[model samples]
Target chain A: MDRSQLLKGLLDIIVLRVLETEDGYGYQILRRLRAAGFDELGDASVYGTLRRLYRAGYLSTYVQPSESGPHRKYYALTEAGRKYLHQMREAWEDVSAKMRALFDIAENGTAEKGRA
Target chain B: MTDTPQKNTDIADYRIAVERHLADLPASIREDLLNGLEEHLAEVSADLKPGVPLSHLLGSPEAYARELRETAEFPRENAGDRFRRSMWRMADPSFAWARGTADKFTGSAGVGEVGEFGRTLRPAWWVLRGFIAAAVVTHIFIFGNDSLREAVLSTGFFGLLFIVAIALAFVWLSLRLGVRAQEWSRRSRRLVAASGIALVAVGMLTFSWVADGFVYYREPVVGYSTAHDVVDEGVSDVYVYDENGELLTGVYLFDQHGNPLYLGDPWSCDDGRVNNPFEQEEQESAVPDPFAATTEPPLDEGRYGYRYPLCPVVEESTGADDPEQPASEPSEEPADADPSDEPTETPSRTPTPDPSAAD
Candidate 1:
């Protein structure tokens, strides 16, 4: 499966999380995502996620003119964005915990069958 | 940060292409989506390697726009909107084909070099478009029915300078607009495109008018000689007389350059009607008499074939006329004659040379 396809659903949460610590512009946010090992992330995916989040009132933007370059529209996580990120994190943990427990039970069942 | 003009143009062009793909979206939403795209693209370009293209780093503009659209969770078009869009697509089948061909060509190898070369020429096209736009605006609003040449001529040197200044202003305005057009709403963009088409139409009409003016100014007026010695005071007929007071016939006159001296309207002798001097066709040879008119001339070489006295008549009244008296009489009679009657009286008065001599 395409990694971008897998990352599609999580882009909003991932982008919100990236903006949590510090407000970042499009290219800078994309860079941070790359550093976090989502190397196959498409450029437009991050931008679209930011747009969606901003539209949903989860992110706020401000224009920060660069000293050496063009002005950048920086995206910061709003109060709503932070709360949403927290909920997403909890939901992700809940699903992963359940999957881990199911995998352990399956492994034990396979082992018992081997013993039989 | 240190982007060259070419780099900036490339980014601007890419951003516009992406925006074009998003034209179906709500204007507010599309504007919001593209608000800071230019700066973002510039940053993206800054991080690229020296020769790396933005499209190479990202994907095709269409794919990028699609990804953006999909990931943004924008509402899909209704069936009716989809149908209308498909109909539009069908209406411009050539546009689609050309776009596909361009995409394929750009995707192939060696396009980078070509693209880079083409990028260098973008500024020149922008400048030319600005000039044409300025010319159209001035021709319509400022110059007011004056052809471009006439406007320039009437305006004189400083006015021309002012016009150039306006064109330069337009160039600056166009360059700025071209860069920022990606941020405009679709409606505004369409309005601009429509105005652009209108401007081009006006420019072409003005250009043709200007071209015709140039042709008119350059064309020499027929029957009016530019030569230094040729008399331009409407000398309709040349009456040459010998020193012995007899009318000269079958005479041919030439200047020092060996070119036959063409004086007056050669067609004036027939039907008492002169041809329109501006008519492009060369005049027929001078007819000796309207009753005896023929296509073939009595003399073979010259255009005005008739000898000096086009209407020759045998002298009836004066058996022997003084040459000095006839010569002096004509000069005074022509000066006193009505200018309108000169051409008609010239042919008829050939035989009556002694009227003043008899007086």
Candidate 2:
């Protein structure tokens, strides 16, 4: 599976999860995501996703004067955004468990068929 | 973060490209996106090695803009934008000139300023204004004295107006685009502004002489002449002047019942030119003059005195005694008739009789 394709669906959730801890500006958020091993993540794409989240009311942003750069916009999860994140995380876990169980059953059934 | 010169230029270039792709976005959305992206770009550039293209960091500006657009709220296309599009597509440059003019009057002259739709009409009106201005200028030059019927039906003049307006639109559009593309410096822009002010000052100075013609066209034709004109046209030696001394031409009169009385337009004459009413009344008396020369065809004079139609204003509304008595007495007063018996105060005309006039 293409990592970029997979990144598309998870980008919003991943961004919300990251911002759930603390508010982070554009470049800082990109660096944190990269450090967390999204090595192939497109830099501009992540910024676009952040903007979408903000517009969607899943995140809120405020400008803070920066010491090193131009004024930076810090994005954080809104209350609505937190609710969305919690709901998506539960759904993801349920899907993940179901898939894992299906894989386990298939493996065991194949071994039994070989022994018979 | 402080951007190096190279970084700033790269960011600018990136933005320009993004803006080009995103030009269709509503102004508010476009501005917000650009401002946010500018700060974001500045931050990213701080950590990048010098000379790395922003395009390298952001894929292509078009793709980046598309992603942002997908995320941003796109309000529906409004009537104003739609109208703007129609004008630009239908008749460019001239309509564009029209647009600028319309914008100047968006909230002016009792027009309700409905957000964008209202704004759209301004440009279209502005475009039509060019045509109107052209028609007016044409009217002054070619049709100033023409009767209304001839002016409206003159296809040649209308064609000329269309051609002139289209030509002007072309020149205006070229100048506008040229100034924009060249990004004229502030000093040059000031020179243009100074020239415009100078032109306006010149217009203000010369406005009075030609202003009457414009007003004459705007007003109803009935305003130009007076009812006295009819009496003057019939009698050659006699002339009509309103109490104010303006030779009453095509003036309207109303009887005590408010019924319209048409005396026709006064015959235009050269001599005995009374321009103002407050001037010496001795020279202004509308009564017939023995020496009144006929500027038109030969007119006959009555033997007894300079004869003129004695038009009297009767206000029967005051319940005065038979109004015919007063109305007849004044018409006979004539230009040189004895004023000794005539009451000087017009308001008292209703109350006073012959004895009051002697007082």
Winner by TM-score: 1
Query: Which 10 consecutive positions of candidate 2 chain B have the poorest summed lDDT?
Result: B296-305
Residue pairs clashing, model 1:
none
Off by over 4 Å in 2: B23-32, B66-359
Interface RMSD for candidate 2 relative to the native interface: 3.3
lDDT of 1 by residue, B134-179 (tens): 8887767677755765767687997789788889999898777766
> Best candidate, DockQ-wise?
1
Candidates in order have lDDT scores of 0.67, 0.58
Among incorrect, acceptable, medium and high, the docking class of model 2 is acceptable
DockQ by candidate, in order: 0.35, 0.31
Clashing residue pairs in all predictions, respectively, total: 0, 19
The TM-score of chain B in candidate 2 is 0.24
What DockQ would you assign to candidate 2?
0.31
Please write out the lDDT profile of model 2 over residues B1-359, one tens digit for every residue: 35788899888888888888888988876777787888788888877778788877778988878866665543345788868866776798886677767755665755644356564564453344344444444555545656743655577788567657654874465355434634688677566556545544554554555787765443322322443443344532232332222231212232233333333332333443432212214433763333233221112211111212222212212112333323334344433443433323221122222343334
